[model samples]
Target chain A: METKELQEIASLLRFEAVRMVYEGGDGHPGPALSSADIVTALYFDILKIDPANPDWADRDRFILSKGHACPIWYAALNERGYFQPKVEHFHLRQLHSEFQGHPSMKNTRGIDMTTGSLGNGIAIGAGMAIAAKATGKDYYTYVICGDGELQEGLCWEGANMAAGRGLDNLIVFIDKNGYQSYKTVDYTVGRNNPAERFMAFGWDVQEIDGHNFDEIKAAVAAAKQNKGKPSCIVCNCVKGKGVSYMENNNNWHKGVPTKEQFALAARELRGISL
Target chain B: MRAFSGSREAFAAALLDMAEYDERVMVISADSLKAMRAVPFGEQYPNRYVECGIAEQCAVDVAAGMASCGLIPFVGTYCGFLTMRACEQLRTFIGYTHLNAKFVGFNAGLLGGEREGVTHQFYEDIGIVATMPGIQIFTPADPAQCYHAIRMAAEVEGPVYVRAGSGREVSVYGNDAPFATSGITVWKRYGTDALLLSNGFVLDRVLAAAELLSQREIHVTVADINILYGDDASEILREMAAANLVVTVEDHNINGGLGSYISKLACENRPVRVHRIALTSYGESGPANELADAYGFSPEAIAQAVAAARTQQ
Candidate 1:
């Protein structure tokens, strides 16, 4: 698909994510909006997935490691026709809801791994990638880790494993959205250069603007072409990328937008006066 | 029967046996390959064997990820580390998802004492894993039974935790021993005066005590309660009910190991005096048998407990 077509779909997914958070009454809309474009770009372009046949043996595996940002993921999966009722009517985090607070591979189709806890995705994705290699299957594993989630020791543990095992089939994208739950990454981890850290671990590094569809496309292409070592594409994104009121605002990390704020967010995403 | 070196060797041999036909079978470790005695598996199928450095959580998550891809991965590590350190990973990813993964916790009971004191001596492993649903635990009698338990873990579908030793376990069952997938297996049945239940490597002591008690005319039906967790063990519960007195012998802690299970069963279902003979505290650096003896896990301790229980009744 063209960049224009992808951007349109991404905007629609962003609106769906914001709406789900507003309706669910509790969710992290900031991180969801921060990761919206990357999520859209992967599902629509980068991933070798079959929404119709989710359990296809050779399909590329994607793990949403920063699982608090699941509204965006639910939006992508729902829009891609993985399951029923669509993103708008979904009962997120409800009793027996497919759209759980964190993504579950068991409850939701198209969810490759269950993640909510910050640091599990990279190791799990590495496992999947190694499994594919062991079985002589041609499939890649892509994992998206939150910038703050990198504080978890398992992320480094997994990064070291991927690099050590020569897991070229694995590609990790760090959603370096500046801000975490309470503050920005700079305020906590000091500069928080995810690309340099992954490179030090011997990974092929590509630092890019996360919201740019073209940059995401190019990094993913470079990552796919790189051999021997695993790749890490640091996606420098805004905490609340598309929403004017939410962008770079740490309060929106888990804050559910009020009626007026939701209207403003809706208008911003839809590019119209709500 | 050919006397195997240790339960750790049986642990490796079983994986070798499974790999003959099942290509999906592989060993994933957190840099404890030698400790697990899985060097042979790694040597045989180097491609399948994965060493995730020293990260226990990564090893388990790798297993969960591999299990999701239809590969049966047996993650091996220290008993205390695997069950405690990567506990959330086990409970959340493997247990909650009900992934087809196997875990062999080496240096169980006091077997790890000689290596490095209390840090390695893990008696709370069974209790920790038992709290999580969808996981079946097996504290096999000895090396032979550990083989059958590890083999059975591969046969079954869901998650299985096989408690093994640091090459210190004595062989209990014969070469042709038939291990039931789940439930208790009676190793010796002299009488029902006092039903003696045991698990893990300490069953050797229980059987010896059973023989000594039999000589003293205090006959008891000795059973190795190897398969600790299953959906139904009513037949064994009925046996426990028939006996006037029940005693559980183990090398693990009395709080949450075999003793606790038998006590809970007798307390809720059938009221009986469940005498527990197991470790009450951690061990210091010593030989496996000396640690076992200090912990009152010797054959004499079992006999003494039985004699005391018999006199009380």
Candidate 2:
């Protein structure tokens, strides 16, 4: 797909995520909006998955390790035709909604693994990669982890094991949005260089603008081409990318927006239907 | 249908058979292959076995990962380390998500160690694991039950915690004993003045107590509760209600173990007098038999408890 088309999809995903949060009365829109471009790039272009057959054995696997941002993931899945992309599909965090607060493999059609707790996705992705190797399958496993989620000790365990085993089939993207739950990532957890850490763990590391389609595509291509090591793409991103009022605002991490704020954000994210 | 001399040996043999049956069956252990006696399985299918060096938390998460990919991964380690150290990881990834991960907790209770002390002994494992919803917990009494339990757990969907022993256990039941997917196994029954519920290697002691009680004219029924927390507690409850007193004996802490579980059942359904005989304190380092005797789980101790319960009634 062209850069323009990817960008269009990214905007639509961001819009749908906001609409889900807005309609559902509450959700973590910050991370959801932040992950829009990366999710859009993977679902629309990079990932080798069939919407009709979510359980295709030979298909590439993707795990959302930072699972609270599932609104964007649900949006991507919906637009990809895993389910109908209707306005009613925006009932994200409802009691019986298949689109739960977190990604559940049993509940969602396109989800490969159930992930809600931070730091689990990377290891599970590594497990799938290990399984692929064991079964002699040639499918790549992609995992998107949040910068805040890296604070968990288990992520390092998976990373260490992935590198030790030389899992070239595994590729990870860390959404390096500076804002975390309470404060900025650096202020909350110090300026921990994920790229340097990945490099030290014997992973091929790349730094890129997360919102940029070209960078994401290039980084993914580079990760695929690289062998004998897992790749980590540290995507420097704004917490709320498109919304003017919500950008870099930690308070928007999770909340139901006011009617005025929702209208303003909808106008900003033009061409997105509610 | 073959049985080994010990539960751990039987467990290892069962794992080998399971691996042979299903290519998806994999084993991940925390660098205790020799201790678990899983060296044969590891050596034969090198790719299927993962020796996750002494990291219980990492091993469990790794197993959870393996389970996610349509593979039946059994994680084995010492009971204390596997339950205490990796508890959160187990609860979150395996328990909460309802993953098909099998946990083989070796050497539960005072049977685990001599040199390692309380760190290796886990009388609190059953209590900790029992709280998790939809988790299948089984404490196999002997080698036959252990072999059958492993095969059954592999066949069952969702998380299964099989508590195996390190002690040289006398056979509670022959190979003919029915190993149902869930529920209690009545080994021997007499006049049901008191129902004796026991599990693990400790069932031998409970049976011995029953024999000693009979000599004293205190007839008690002995049953091995292999399935700890299954759907049908109805059978066990009915037996408990029939008896004048219910006595639960386990090689676990009295707080949240089988004793506590039975006591709760008695309070709710039977309203019968319940006596819980289990370890009251952290265990000390000694030989396994000596530890059992010291901790009031010996045949003499159990018989004394039965006599005390008869007096109370």
Candidate 3:
């Protein structure tokens, strides 16, 4: 759980995520790589979970609302001992693979809810939090959603409910990578700040450097400390975090990387700063 | 003929009965507690009631989430909003996962919310909900069937969509009548010349149509298709094959409703000629009975359609 070890895990997750996209022939590598650090921190440093007992009643729930970046989640889960790292782990998006293009609760391990459609995770997580509150369980629910997913109206519907009901046990992280499907989120939508939007919806909002482990840990800790309101941590991130050529490139959002690009991404994630 | 009684009251009574025994039974509404007659349930089990306040999509996804954690959440809302407004959430969150969520679509079909115009009245929900795989669609006739269908929904696991009709209910079966888990329930078997299939409040019209046909010396088999989806179909198919003609009557649109299902079943299994007496177009604002009559779902209209089919045969 040291900073260096967490950094190492994040790098490895990035490498695995890139490699999975490369092997699978089709995936959102940009989003996956962008969320590598946040996912790594949650699995390794933050979330209270048991890989052997994914359905433990007292375990904290994690929902990846931005589900296209599931390769990052799969990588983190594999490294956290949820499942053994196998050659097939790289067979993401292939027919019948446990790692689907999007997170499937039925197919994936350690996934509490199936979320492919945008804006659903917030409500589902709120439901979990409400269940915990109603049942006298104290387990927290953590949801990681993409900034682009904010365009979906259903997200606010859930967000409004969560805040209205005072779901303090819920914590959400918006991966503000700026890019959506084809272009920047601001270019596609307006330059709306997620911090202001969630705050206006009665959430406890905070801005953080998404790739910075210290800020990520501190923000989550701060969110946990706050009471009587659901928390939203806006993590500003690069489209592709660890790779040089794929960084901020929208075309790399889905296309499988060439052999040279894959090798270059792998080398960069293996301790190269650039 | 008995007076028309709304099924929403029966649904509320059944929901309250279930909530009394099962602690997991909770109701989530889009601010439709009064419309759904779930006030008593809310008052008795205040902790179990959730008011989502007009956000149907959030209500459904919230129910899906609650179901994930071992709670049976029933969503109560108007059929128009519940089926279309929150359809994506239903399809992805509840239907895809087959969550233990029950959706009671109050005010279903063209006869539902007659004065509310096309905005509130939905005649296309059955078809839309039928497209979602693994979600059982239940269309109940009379208050007794409504009670039984809701009770079944609470006891059954996975996703269940109960198409609870609006006000203006008719008694098709007695309170003590047994509920069928699959296939159609035969209420009046006059003859095998035609298989008359109908459900929900429209069954009353179909029954009256049968009586009118009997006056014309045309005896027909009258069966209420209480269970819409997940039927074993062997018994229903046998009943269909026995008849030379099959006439399906409903208060819903012809496409993707009971008529379409029966027609497909007959064409595939029995090869019988099928005639559908249903709303082929959208509903407009009017009195419920007047709308029903104009939409070609009245007793006289159904009888005429059946007589015409008989002549063709």
By DockQ, the best candidate is: 1
Q: Candidate 2, which CAPRI tier?
A: medium
- With a 3 Å backbone cut-off (N, CA, C), the pairs that clash in candidate 1 are none
lDDT of 3 at A145: 92
Q: Considering summed lDDT, which 10 consecutive residues are worst modelled in model 1 chain A?
A: A83-92
Q: What is the DockQ of each candidate?
A: 0.87, 0.55, 0.77
> How would you order the candidates by TM-score, starting with the best?
1, 3, 2
Question: Residue-wise lDDT of candidate 2 within B222-305, one digit each (tens)?
Answer: 988888878889888877877988888988888988888888878777688888898888988898788788989889999999
> Considering only chain A, what is the TM-score of each predicted structure?
0.97, 0.97, 0.96
Candidate 3 residue lDDT tens string, A124-227:
89888888887788888999999999999989998999998899999999999999998899898878599999999999999999999999999999998999
Name the lDDT value of residue B175 in candidate 2: 68
lDDT of each residue in A103-218, candidate 1, tens digit only: 98889988889999889999999999999999999899999999999999999999999999999999999998888877878899787888889989999999999999999999
Q: How many residue pairs clash in each candidate?
A: 0, 0, 0
Candidate with more favorable, higher lDDT: 2 or 3: 3
lDDT on C-alpha atoms for all candidate structures = 0.88, 0.85, 0.86
Per-candidate TM-scores read 0.97, 0.95, 0.97
